[model samples]
Target: MSILLILALVVAMGAVLYALVRGVIAMANGKDVSGEVQQGYMQKRVLYQGIAIVIVVLLLVVAKSNGS
Candidate 1:
């Protein structure tokens, strides 16, 4: 269970990274002058970060319960 949580945490973190990179690229390209598209990527990054944080909390709880 801990391993699964860890794997999920990694995937979530990767998604955050991906979103951040895409957002940066979009901003650099200046293709979306209205900034709506960039905002969407930012939102995704935030969501993924939240998921990663939640997974970390769950992992900690599991570890504590297991007396690790």
Candidate 2:
């Protein structure tokens, strides 16, 4: 159970990193970010990151609660 949580967190973080890098690369290419498509992608990425953070916090809280 704990192992599953750890693995999920790792995958989530890796996905977050991948999305961030892709965004950075697109921006670096001098592509305009004002387009709706880019904005949507950015929004989705933010949502993913937010979800990841929530999951991580919850996992840590649960682990601490159990450890106590």
Best by lDDT: 1
- In the range 1-68, model 1's lDDT, one tens digit per residue, is 99999999999999999999999999999989999989999999999999999999999999999995
| C-alpha positional error of residue 39 in candidate 2 after TM-score superposition, expressed in Å | 2.6
Best by TM-score: 1
Relative to the true structure, candidate 2 has a C-alpha RMSD (angstroms) of: 2.1
Worst 10 residues of 2 by lDDT: 33-42
Q: What TM-score, computed on C-alpha atoms, does each candidate reach?
A: 0.97, 0.71
**How would you encode candidate 2's per-residue C-alpha lDDT over 1-68 as one tens digit per residue?**
66777787787777777777777766667667576555665676787788788778888888999999
The lDDT of model 1 is: 0.96
For candidate 2, give the lDDT of residue 64.
96
Candidate 2 runs further than 4 Å off? none
Weakest 10 consecutive residues of candidate 1 by summed lDDT: 23-32
- Clash counts per candidate, in order, are 0, 0
lDDT, each prediction: 0.96, 0.75
